[model samples]
Target chain A: MGKPTGFLEFHRELPANRTPSERVSDWEEIHVHVPTDTLKRQGARCMDCGTPYCHTGKLIGGMASGCPINNLIPDWNDLIFRGQWKEAAVRLHQTNNFPEFTGRVCPAPCEGSCTLGLNDDPVTIKSIECSIADHAFEEGWIVPDTPGTRTGKRVAVVGSGPAGLAAASQLNHAGHTVTVFERADRVGGLLMYGIPNMKLPKSMVERRVRLMANAGIRFVTGVEVGRDITAKSLLSDWDAVVLCCGAAQARDLAIEGRNLSGIHLAMEFLHANTKSLLDSSLADGAYISASGKSVVVIGGGDTGTDCVGTALRHRARNVTQLEILPKPPASRAPDNPWPQWPKVYKLDYGQEEAAALQGADPRAYSIQTKRFVGDESGQVREVHTIDIEWKKSPDGRMHIVELPGTERVFPAELVLLALGFVGPEKKGLVHELGLKLDERGNVVTDGEKMTSVAGVFAAGDMVRGQSLVVWAIHEGRKAARGVDRYLMYGQSYLP
Target chain B: MSDAIWTAGEVPHVLFVGDESGCRDELTAALGAGWAIQPANDGIHAMDLLKHPNRPASIVVVLDLSMPVLEGFGFEKARRADSELSHIPVVLVTSHAADERVKKFGARAYVKRPIVVGDLAAVVRELGEG
Candidate 1:
């Protein structure tokens, strides 16, 4: 919309990524900043279409199609086009409670649904959004928007992940006394530990936490809700409770030799790496280093990708990611269309870096690990794999049929199970509260975002199962509105 | 019209009814999100698009509240009154801050302009049942 013919004039381009070879030497962010003038030119390609699908948070073909929090994509695109940086920040913050996290880590589904993408390359909505948010931070336009009047109400948000932080932010804006309880030593759950520092520096997460603290949201870390203070006591102490506990029960690989010493859950490995990096800048030896070892990452998703990147950073001799599913087509399939989430092959930053160093993609698709072959010292030394073929069974259910005589073994001292999470852990908090769980083990909630228990609510990964940061923010905002409604009979100033 | 949306197997056909350039542009932009978008100046033109070969198995209507020939309320009424268009759901797009006509016309959702196009697309998804 900035320039009527800008789409024709300018091609869809982003900041040149730091060369894979140079970036792997350290844990700094991989992307280099593009000039402000270039971003403006990119914004000029907004096309002012009658309909913009980029912000549609709807699920198409069972996958996310647009920004889940429904960021006003076109508004910021226009604002950036006009170089009205501050106004763009205001519009961005209106929807996304945390754009910097999403800007860094999120796979940009909004761009896939871009109107221009149907004809040409989609507008660089994510980059533009990031530029606006980052610029806001640089200009010091982002300050504590603390509520003017106190509502004399108390709300406790459990687990200091994206969802809990978002809920706290909204409730604080609505003039409610909010306290976020985190079991971790630090405030951010996944943001601080689960995600590696290179992608999102912990300083960014800390900056937001400090801002929330200034905005009147109190954070109580190193305190598990059901353990330290029983769920019943918190129910009495706080007027309303929101469970933002993430789905962190990592799905374990039950293959033979799972008891091997070197095999670790993806979260455990990442958590140690980040904590050690923070403690002594990787000098404390608190983390499981993949240095000088052949590492085999089981499962080929974001978690697996992160493991590969982390192992490479630690100077692993070689890294291989085994994916159970067959490789996706290089292009979108007929069933997968525009505006819907495309199932195309993409070499993410991790895979890109691995390729640059190893001279090939680190992923080995349609492969399954049969067992972790260990050495005499009882440490994983190699992983045996077999090829798999998926076919429809007689009952019309698809089954993974093992292909014959494709057995192969790869040397490995470290084997990280980067398999995805199953659901929220149900032993402590869920058991103590007696919360109702859906068939898939997620907390069940009503239309009002209120859980089965009265005045108690659930949001984010706890309710939606494991999902993107954007959805967590969306749920957090909704749960806060529900809490506000419960506190003041239908008079919630929360959006 | 020969675009990615057309190449994709099948998608919901959205009939847009409005008199302003904003409405036309909105319809044109919606095309990028892989919908068979049919733009009409008013209710009558929209109905014509629905009758042609573009007659989609699943269709949703996006109507602007105010127009020259047929207003949103009239368009919805006419649509409901006719048997052929009764099953089709309508979503209202309005520029006015305080528009209550959408409620009267029974639009599934109303997206205010300085619009986020995603809102309209989301409502269409809900109504399209896709």
Candidate 2:
């Protein structure tokens, strides 16, 4: 617990983000550094209840209501209140393998489930969590904790995303020889390419990968499991195999004129922008340029917001995000009670930046794209859309009804589909290994996270479909335990 | 729970232990082809479906925590007590997060409220295949 009267004495506060006009100009992080005193006072506001739901890591309303990895949140919050930054970092790392990544990208479900949120604002848990990790890094508290003794077994991890990395880290710490196979030229899967640098600096990903490598974890980049080497070969070579290959199959809007030249998946636009930016600082001109173009981003999710932000950074003429779902309420509805993730509307970083620059928020809610109108040259020129209403039928099933005479068109040269992912790509390693797929096309796993094959296990988005990075880490850790137990004759020391 | 086996049509692959509402049809549609869904008013009806001798070979039970007769926990207790049905996987659906005790009850996974079709389908399919 924190200070007894801390919640009463102090109000919840967070460090102000960098001015959108300023931060959007460069690829630097959006947050402005907060003073240690301010962070400490903020930490003191935690009212640790008799039963803390912040670390329950439970799913409510099909969404994460707390920390997915179940970080000892109160302990760390108390530690931070006492100004014991190092101890806070230790408590964080005990559960989350990479607080640095989560501290940046996580939507802070912990805050949503904070007991204090029942009345007043919740504790500034996310900012405090981030500050603890950042402080640890600055003071050199984080390092490669190589195991003293090595187990004779070897494990192979496919897809070096959050899940793959978490599994690899845990397995290596358990004294097993671990090899992480990544298809990308760089180490991180989504961390490297899927996310923009401004959100999660590539250096952070590289730093962690470097530490793991130093701890004797072999990273083989640019090697596809089913293509570079056969999945059968990996199964034969390693004592156990874990599939951390993310659910990368992006959902498509296969409407009319989908084959137009300028239409691109959100990942393609993001991956190239980051790669080119990192590779040559955009001087090489290898990315799909949004410069001087009207950008239309379909699907109003985090990925869509990222596209909007990136398009703004590229100095797009204009940007608009089309969301098929109705706008959420400004405050939590009666049904979305305490300890449940409040289904409320709030502008994300990208939307904030867009609003700061543009006259209005760049989101068009309850709209559906009819078709992409392309020119004779096959370059997408405009996006046709119509407003829609959502109504629950007599049967209690929600259905979309297109509104009449509400058609609108927006000029666009670039159409980014941020409609989210379907599931793991089934063509390569998943197919080669003959793994069973769920109805939604995610890899099917048993209770132990083991796939249909005895020696092979799957985790993360690959098994759970497209999900948060925190959940990926959770899955990765679980799969590591499963793999360890199998290799050690139904015994495992991994937590 | 009755021991009467299903005789007509295909024995349902899933025993949905929850309210008799739109969720069953929604789940059935979301589960797509090959999955035949049979609804239960509560845990009691679910037990009867489980006890059927002609139940599908790869059947799974999707239970809701808050229900009328023989709730999810109670059904789990009775199901686990039976040696023949103990190994079958059960996925729990709830509006709030279930505590760690659910894992001790042998629930394979949890699907929260405001259910996403894809997510529920994935969990049920994985548990069914298991």
Off by over 4 Å in 2: B1-130
Q: Clashes in candidate 1: how many? A: 3
Off by over 4 Å in 1: A394-396, B1-130
Candidate 1 has which clashing residue pairs, if any?
Answer: A50-B25, A50-B26, A51-B26
Question: lDDT tens digits, residues B23-122, model 2?
Answer: 7888888988888887776655677667767777677888898775456776787788778888888888877665776556557788888888789899
Question: Measured with DockQ on alpha carbons, how good is candidate 2?
Answer: 0.01
Docking class of 2: incorrect
Q: For candidate 1, write residues A368-478 as lDDT tens digits.
A: 899988988899998999999989999998889888999999898999998899999998899999999999999999977898899899999999988888888899999
What shift in Å separates residue B59 of candidate 1 from its native position after superposition?
56
Candidate 2 TM-score, C-alpha based:
0.79
Per-residue accuracy of model 2 over A41-139 as CA lDDT, tens digit each: 888888777788999989988988888999999888899889889889999999999999998999889999999999889988888888888899999
User: What is the RMSD of candidate 2?
Assistant: 17.9
